[model samples]
Target: MNKSELEKEINEASERIKTRQSEIETEIDRLGEQISKFTNWAWIFVWIGAFVSAFALIYFICTNTEKGFGLNLLGDFMAGTVASVWSLAGLFFIYVAFLGQKQQLLNQQLEIMYSQLEVKYTRLELSGQKAEMAEQNKTLRRQRFENTFFQLLSNHQEIVNGIDLKRVRDGSWTTSAEGRDCFSTFYERAFPKGFRLRKHPIEPTVEKYAEFYKVNQSDLGHYFRHMYHILKFIKKSKELTKEEKYNYSNLLRALLSSYELLFIFYNGLSEAGKPKLKQLLEEFSMLKNMDFELLINIEHKKEYKEIAFASSEERKKLLRTKK
Candidate 1:
């Protein structure tokens, strides 16, 4: 579920609750109106009774006032008192009716509040679903990418290229001017540098590989491009020619395998990662009498550059144990 879905469900639930609340309000209103009508009629009847009694008592007093005029006047005063008391009773009933109406209004408001809470509950549920969906998509993509990356690795099985060169730069998402998110964060953190080497063309360095194994990146694209064009070739390997396939295969295996293997060896032992520096006098086959003393020269300040081609075996012999 997504945010909107939960919100909508909440809205629906609220509407239902509101509708019930409206019905309750209607019932309360009806009862209130009836109570008001009864109170009004009672007051009218009390006034009418007072009027009829006053007329009859006046007629009787006038016809038989030979006993005492003062007593007749007192009887008329008592009749007036009875009428006022009945009127006061009607007013009391009206007050009770107002109290009932107030209670009903309170109940209606409570119902509305309850409806809103239900809406909120639905919204929360939907938000959780959306989060779960996003996570699942990330997991699926990571699994797919891993399978594909490894598949390319298996086809091309070259060791690390010591002479290979690569460019390192920032993981600028300049192309994706839209914005960056967690995905971009992942990629940048994982591949902090962009190194595009020839022998290790579009390299994913040993350091970066180790990082990826530890956690998934937020995004795979940096500078709005892939790790290499090998990515495209990997995707279309089935349709690519043999040379294209081998190129991708070799690229992936040469860089990735060495990177992964290097980390594995590092994890297996502590000293394996950072060995004491050593130097070889000659990169080729070791000579016995040539310069054995140079091995421990301890002069690390030496600069040399060679621009030439060498076979795999020749390059291996050239790998002096870095001092």
Candidate 2:
């Protein structure tokens, strides 16, 4: 059953058990009081009968001795007959007392059974509560992961926009390095001397512009760091859905599909920075074979291929294969 249904069922069961236990306890107390009263009355009656029998026997012996141990009205069998009748009366009382004790014992046993059943019901109720708590914890964890993923996606927009593929394709941000060692001091030769901007919009296709061309650009470090953390989070997260992973991967692929943008970013990185960029690509597993031209052509078509569901581990495997 679903969580709410299961919880409701468990609560109902617990309430029923609690009510039954309370009723059983009430019955046990009632039976206990009744048994106590019966025991007291039975003992009082038995003692009274014993005392009267003793007095009668003593009087009979004293009065009948002078009459030759026999009564005038009764024969020699008179004493024997009286004794036999008294023994039968005592046996009847004993039988009645025994039956009362048996009834008390049976009630006590019934109370014990009820007590055991109550304990079992309590345990069952506790188990249900624990199960519900566990499910809630799982749901909370999944929700947190989803929130973090969306936040990262929102933050990465500025970084993605920095690499303007259209600008690179249209021959913007070009400068002259007319008579200098273009290969050795490309950065200095391409831009105006001693000119520095806080942010330069570096095109992704820097290879198309053979010389170092600097325009207003922002620091790409934050963007890369954010992307790295996102990948790591996906790798470690147990709660993310396969479809969620696929969507994240698809977003990365969309950024990479821009031919000039991908080339410029990869080509412009320093020797040390190249490996870090490669590592980032591997994390996203976006190096997989994706025909950008074909995708663009089919962008508005109904027959366009859909992104496939993939987990973080499965996405990592894509990095092992060359594009």
Candidate 3:
């Protein structure tokens, strides 16, 4: 059964056990009351028996003691009768004492049962407290994770804002672009318009990316490294599920401008990003929102896995069509 149904069953069983315990206690009380009444009646019987026996002995002595009855004989008869009566009364007292001891033992057993029940209830309460504490700890962990995640996101945006590019002209530098505009300027410079296709496009592409990266390493290096760490942070988190990691990565992806995505696409193929950053890019599907039309060569898309550019649903559809 599911958790709720199982819990319901356990609760019902506990209630049944409690009800049975109560019934047993009630029965013990009733038995105790009967025993008390019987003991009281036994005491009355003992007293009545002693009184009747005394009266009979006195009547016999008065009626049967005639002329020539010896004093010694009469004294012997009275002693024997008194001894028998005392013996009978002593037996009745022993039985009454036994009943009293039995009642005491029963009371002790009831007390022990009550104590055991109290301990079980205390254990159950402690278990509930532990579960509540565990839930609170989980909530705190989630809050801490989200705080760090959003802070890193904000830092990434700040880094993007600080980016700028200057073009060299006649021994002087002029600011050619700033912020997001710098990415487009870098892309145009790296991949000139109407460039002839190389025999091996991959090598030439990497060379172009390396050269462009060297020229603007200071600005681009920090941006790429920060972006890579952001994604890497999400990937390394043990707290997040696969879907949660994907959603967080998508949130970071949403902040990137089209030119920024274009720059990232080529960056991942270059030497600087191939080892670690490229894998993280594909894992998080970082290029899922890239505009294919922006690429200098559309065939460059084939270098990465299909998952890098397509969403899960789109990938599934592609798979079905291939099949």
Candidate 4:
């Protein structure tokens, strides 16, 4: 049974035991009164019998009609009467003693029962305390994971805010863009109009993206690395369930503009992100919300696995199918 139900049962049992104990005590008290009354009556009977025997002996001595009535006869009569009276009193005392012993035995049995009940109650109370501690520990673990998770999220935002890109025209810098706007410039530089007009092999596309990325590595490298670490942190946490991880990753995904997703989509195809980031993207469905029309070549959307863009239910169905 659950803790509350068990505790309630114990409380009810305790009440019953207390009531029984009170009843036993009252019965012992009543027996004591009965024993006291029996002793008093036994003493009164002994005194009355002694008085009658003495009066008969005195009367016999005073009204002796025969000279043969002697002291020996009177002595025998007195001895027999006194012995009988004392024997009756002794039997009454013995019966009272038997009742007293019976009451003591009942009290002893009750005490033993009470001790056993106390032991069971103590054990149950300790079990309840252990259960409470386990729940508290679980709560504390979740709080710690959330604290670090949100901190990483905040750091990711700072990196995004720090990004800046400048456009140069006629050998002089003309315009500048910052934050989420910078990814559009990065995407345009990496995939120009002529590059998208003709169908290109995957290797050449990767190589071309790599060359453009090399030129802008100074601004892009740290941003991608930090982003990778954030996803990695969520993946490595043992405290989070699959659903919890998905929710947190979706929060990170929400921060990215469409251009940011485009950049990430291409980045995943390169050698830099292939080893780990690509798999993480699929695992979290990071591209589920990507704007497919924004890609330089719409067909590029098919390059990654379906899991990268599948909804949570779709991912589950895919997993079951695989199994």
Residue pairs of candidate 3 with colliding backbone atoms: none
> lDDT for each of the candidates?
0.42, 0.47, 0.73, 0.79
Ranking by lDDT: 4, 3, 2, 1
Give the Å error, residue 159, model 1. Answer: 95
User: Which digits, one per residue and each the tens of the lDDT, describe model 3 over residues 1-323?
Assistant: 44455445545655765676566557656765666666666666667657756775676668664644565655675567755655666666677677667756765664455444444434443555547544544554565467568868977987887787777998989987888888888777887775524323667877877898898899999999999988989998887887789889988999998889988988999887888888988877889889877777788899898878879688556657867
TM-score on alpha carbons, each prediction = 0.27, 0.33, 0.55, 0.57
lDDT of 4 by residue, 13-121 (tens): 7678778877886887798778888888788878877887878688778867666666677777767787678778888888888888987887776666666655555
- Model 1, 1-323: lDDT tens per residue? 66676667656765776676567657756765676676777777677767766765786678665756575665766667766667676776777677676756766565456645544664574567656544543443443444446643432322121112223448532333212233233334444433322122112243444455444222222211222333453545444453444344444434432223222222222222223101111121112122212211212112111201223344444444322
lDDT, residue 299, candidate 2: 30
Give the alpha carbon lDDT tens digit for every residue of 1-323 in model 2. Answer: 55466556555655665576556546645654565565566566566656665666676678776855555434334445544555655665566566556655754654454454444434444656666565554554564566457656654654554332222435664433222122223333333243323222233223223333323123334444666666666766787565566556566555543432333233324342345544444444454443333222223222111212124555545434424
User: Higher lDDT: candidate 2 or 4?
Assistant: 4
Q: Is candidate 2 or candidate 3 better by TM-score?
A: 3
Each model's number of backbone clashes?
12, 10, 0, 0
Candidate 1 lDDT trough over 10 residues, lowest sum = 276-285
The superposed Cα distance between candidate 3 and the true structure at residue 197, in angstroms, equals: 6.9
Mark the regions of model 2 whose C-alpha exceeds 4 Å error after superposition.
Answer: 1-132, 161-219, 241-247, 255-257, 260-277, 289-323
**Top candidate, metric lDDT:** 4
Clashing pairs in 2: 199-216, 199-217, 200-216, 200-217, 201-216, 201-217, 204-261, 204-264, 205-260, 206-264
State the RMSD for candidate 3.
39.3
